[model samples]
Target chain A: MATQTTDVGQAVGGAAKVGMPQLDFSTFSNQIFWLIITLVVIYFILSRIALPRIGGALADRAGTITNDLAEAEDLKSQALAAEEAYEKALADARAEAQNINVLMRAEIQGQLDEELAKADAQISGRTKEAAAELAEIRNAAKANVKVVAKAVAKEIVAALGGKADAKTVTAAVTERMKG
Target chain B: MATETHGEAEAGLVFHPMDQFQVTPLFGAGPVEWFTITNATLWMGLSILVIFVILVLGARGRALVPTRSQSIAELAYGFIYKMVEDVTGKDGVAYFPYIMTLFMFIVVANFLGLLPMAFTTTSHIAVTAVMAMAVFLAVTVLGFVKNGFGFLSVFWISSAPLILRPILALIEVISYFVRPVSHSIRLAGNMMAGHAVIKVFAAFAPLVLISTGIGLVVTPLSILAITAIYALEVLVSFIQAYVFAILTCVYLRDALHPHH
Candidate 1:
């Protein structure tokens, strides 16, 4: 600390003249000197090291964010491609199933049509043979009737008390059969 | 309370509110020679040391996910950088370091003063004027250096009527010269007034005991006023620092684009 006299001397010399010490011009150079010193030091620290570090941190964060977003976008596009491929595979499988069903129906219909055609041919051949047999039986029956008629007429004529000729009886019987 | 008042009585209750601002040589008994270390110098140095510790050492880690101290340092850096960039546009960003230095010094000095028994160097015109004058000189020189004789057009009002152009130019020149005066005074005045008001209220804290009955009511009231004013001064300190820095940016903007 300064001696009382010197302190008083300085105080009276400068501060006392001006009501406020701030208005005291005598101390301006000292304040200015320190101000310059402090400012210069602060400027160097901020410019050289402190500011650059902060700027680096900010730039790093922005780069990381951009990189992450790009990766996420790539992943999203890949997922979309996979989904499209899956859908296409599903549609292809459905078309194959439909094709198989149509082929089986066509094959089964061909087999059923072949069986029906064979059965129809067998029935038509049996009806034709039965009709020929019927016609032959009818002709044989008519010939027998004529022979029996001639015999019966001759016997009747003999039993009656009148003589009967074989030629007359045959002629009458032939006429009647013809009519 | 009685003991406190007793101490005050023994020390003589005369309160020298302005005594806190007095500049004294810190060392030997002598006049404050140009180089003599003084209280003002000590506090100014302390402000610088505090800023260095917070910004340089605190940011040494420089983590992606920053520590608390690192976060503070980064925040201050970004805040001033953005301010300078926005106010003066991209071209003016080159001066960011200087502007940032001014902001840090004033803010630190203002905050340091809030400490008990601390000297507020920023409250004096001596300190603030130097900074303001520096801004003024730097801007003026830049304006001239960049624009040559065309720099005088900043004061000329070409848009005004022909008859009024000369008169407007005169007004502009006067206002331009007043920039440093207003800039320095605005900060120092605000700081000094707030501090002095707080001190005045504090001085009254002990005055109540002189009146026996009134002491009970007045002492608490005085304390309350001190609390209120102290809070206001804290806000004032931050605002004044911000104002000084931003105004510097505005002036820098003019230098870069005088047409505006």
Candidate 2:
């Protein structure tokens, strides 16, 4: 019975061994060595080359931003100057127009006054000439009338003979003119 | 009937690829038997090749205004710069190359392992242990170079009272030795556990199919779990890489300043 149990035990142990895979360690050492080597090489590259370039790029970006901002400010100042000049020119033009209008109005008014004066002077001269002609005609008419009256008076006096007094002669002359 | 079922179940369980890749002796040689070119090695090689190509291509044009490749290179450099600055302050600039290289290498290796049929080197204790050991050795050497015998004072807790100095020194020494072990295990354990769980769930997918409608439901669920785990692994890979780099920086600090 003991011998039988031992055989059974051995059978069980053998069966157990069949299912299990053996472990391997050589692979572990190889893995460890290569991991170290790779890490070391990576360290070398990063330290020697990559980092400095990144730092330089960052600095360059900062410089570019600053330059762009300064350029923008300069353009703003130039725009402001242009705006000021434009406004000044507009104001000057407006002021010049006002001055021209004033000068033009004064010259127009002076010319109108001269024309009015010349027209008045010509009218006055014509009136004076007409007045003088009227005066001469009146004088001539009066003289002719006086002569006729005198002739008439002389005839009446001859006819009247003894009624040749001044008052009576005057009264006869007025009665003849009335008829 | 249950005993028979249990026996059959036990018999059906098989050793997986992960078990086969474990750090064990082959053919009864010794611990040295574990050394071999494996999936982990392949992934690591691929990682190096990829990084090398990217850097070489990125740097080739060298234009005054950056091209796309140059821009990518600059971005990577800038990223590392910020990381170093945050971790080590302005003095970190001097060590920027080392930390950046370390971060990229580990990140690529971790990401490569996520590919189908790829080996994760960071998943093995032996591999991660070796890396941590390298860092420890480098930092130790740097400490001695920079501070000479003064570095030995770091273990003594010089700020403590004289009475407590001896005890603090012993504790500090022990903690120092534990650094490499913890660092390696932190990365390796996370990777191994995550991958193992994924494999186990995947194996269940087909087994659940041996049943009828239940198998169909379980299989989809298993697949979904696998997908979720994959996403988590990707996240963990990045986190581990960051942790490793940050820890390396801390160690470098220790080297630069011994007492602190």
Candidate 3:
């Protein structure tokens, strides 16, 4: 405790110094020798253990950072790929929907066309039958008119005091109608 | 100015700032032997222990997300590592451990010295000189071994004009030899000067008890100066360590690539 005022002194009191202790040649070897030993010990400890450990820690941090960045980049690309696939799928679904619409429209049109064609066929057939029936009625009416005219001619001849045969009257009437 | 007696029956203010640098045996007062464990040894050993705890033990977790102490350890490691790689190039990374050892030791020793009444090991010329000399000798040897005679090209600046090349080489040689001396002195001088100045200011702080008249002015001023200087010393100590390490890198670069 008393000698605590050595160079690494605990003593704060002023003890007179002779010349410069640094310039004092007697203590040079002691300081130099100790410094050498301190340095050697430090060098060995650092080289053997401390330096490598610290260096490895730093390197490990860098590697971890790099790996984390790479993983982030990879995830970003994957997200991009997923979005692209979703867009493609969406586009495909839209196209399929349009295709189904076109197919449905065409089928409905074909069905409508078939119904119109069948209706046309049925109407034409009914018109032809009706025309034939009108022709028959016209013919019947003409025959009836001719018979009535023959009867009337006969009655008129009898009333005018000129007696004639039924066969003759019929013949006359038929000739008139022909003219 | 040295000690002075002011009045009878009163202890005059004593300020022996240089006395703080005196080397003495930690055990007992006697002649310091070459192997005697002095206060210098105690502080150096303490610094090593500090480094071990902060670096070796602190980084033991090897966490991807570092804790506070681990962060400091990794920060120092990365700072010096990047500096070495940048200044010394890729090949110089192999000497990172040695450089880190020097950096940690010096910086830790310097900060430890700032503690009240603690010995400043790095302030000693003997200590810094050895480190600087070691760097110098290692770089010199490595240069010679690696480049052989080609290492001489570092001194011979072929980029200069023919006439100036010899002069420049002479200058380069002198500068190269002076590197160790300047490197060591720069750290030691800065540490010693700052501490001594603080001690000087502290010695004046007692003026308040001695003479209340001047003490009123000198006491506050001296105290303020000590505070300010103490803060500056903190910055200086760290800077000196960084300077020393970076300078080592520069020297290593020259050795590895002596041609340029």
Candidate 4:
């Protein structure tokens, strides 16, 4: 304080002669003291309080960003897996639909083939019965014609008053029929 | 008083641009006492307060999503941290707070000085010199404490020819000691010159009345020059602070690894 007072007097007396106060030695110590105090206070505040909090905030933000990215990646992979499963399900459904179509076609074809076979069997049975009836009618008519021709021969013989053998006539008629 | 009237009668224009830098005792016209608070002290204190508000109160939320003030605080923190990490490497990280303090104080002081009628504390060599000297002393002490006598190898250029080694060493030693002077002067000089230029241009405003229509042309042009210089000074303010911090980091790097 004593030195400061002496310097204070020198500053006041020399103030008129000084060209630039910055060069004045009397005031430098005071400026230096304040500078030190300011710097020290700022250093403590920055180191102890401000810088650490800012650093923490930065680190926290970084961690959040990293976590969000990881979660997004996980969700993306999950979406891809779900898409793959959906495609698989779609393909299975398509295959099942195709299988059903093929089975229905085959069953319908089997039923159509069975109906055609039943109709053919009934037509063949009708055709065989008509052929058998025609054959029997022809046989009965031939026998009737043979019997009538013999009776007419015997009558003509009697009407001529001649002695004719019935057996011979019958034999002749039988021989003619054979030819 | 008669000389002033005579000077004005003769069309003489008087202006003292440097008078603005005078450090008068804030309370009285008397001599500045050791404990006497001056404009420099007030501005310096304001710089500190601003720093505190921005760094402390601004980041009070510490929210995951930062507010504007929080973002500003984070930006300043990240900017200086990255600069230190890049310039001085991991070894210099320990001194980050000191470097940060210097950068914040200087930048704040410079910007605050731009206010009309406000004093620029950093414009004085007395302020910058102490800061530079502190860095120099701390680095020098750290170098010795860490490297012992081996720190002296910083001056010895082993890569040189044996005959030229002593000459190179002497040059290196001279440059090494010149660090603080150049460091302090660079900031102080830059701030002082810019402010002085603006003041000089402003002084030309009143010369208009004496020079017929010349003042008309000079006044606007002077304002224009002041505007341009003020813009440049704003840039210089930030740059000088960055330069000071980066240079300190470089010096610290040397102290940490003196062999290189």
Highest lDDT scorer = 3
Order the candidates by TM-score, highest first: 3, 4, 1, 2
Q: In terms of docking quality, how is candidate 1 classified?
A: acceptable
Quote fnat for model 3.
0.81
* lDDT, residue B151, candidate 3: 97
User: How would you class the docking of model 3?
Assistant: acceptable
Per-residue alpha-carbon lDDT of candidate 4 for residues B1-260, written as tens digits (9 for 90 to 100):
65655456335544445555666567766666666777778988999999999999999999999999999999999999999999888988988999999999999999998888888999999999999999999999999999999999999988889999899999999999999999999999998889889888887766666664566788789889999999999999999999999999999988999896
Best-to-worst ranking by DockQ: 3, 4, 1, 2
Which should have the higher TM-score, number 1 or number 2?
1
Q: Per-residue lDDT tens digits of candidate 1, residues B174-253?
A: 99999999999999998888878878778767756565455677678889998998899889888999999999999999
- What is candidate 2's lDDT per residue for A1-179, written digit by digit as tens? 34443454334322222222222333445555656666666666655655555566667777888999999999999999999999999999999999999999999999999999999999999999999999999988876776688677877778977556666766666676568
Candidate 2 structure quality by residue, lDDT tens digits, B190-241: 8777887887777666645355445567778989999999999999998998
> How would you encode candidate 4's per-residue C-alpha lDDT over A1-179 as one tens digit per residue?
34443455456444553356679887887788778888999999999999998899999999999999999999999999999999999999999999999999999999999999999999999899988899889889878767876777767787788656889878877787778
lDDT for each residue of candidate 3 in B66-89, tens digit (9 for 90 to 100): 999999998898899999999999
Interface RMS for model 1: 3.6
Residue runs of model 3 more than 4 Å from their true location after superposition: A1-16, A148-164, A168-179, B1-11
Name the weakest run of 10 consecutive residues (lDDT summed) in model 1 chain A.
A1-10
- In order, candidate lDDTs are 0.84, 0.71, 0.88, 0.86
Best by TM-score: 3
Q: What is the lDDT of residue B111 in candidate 1?
A: 93
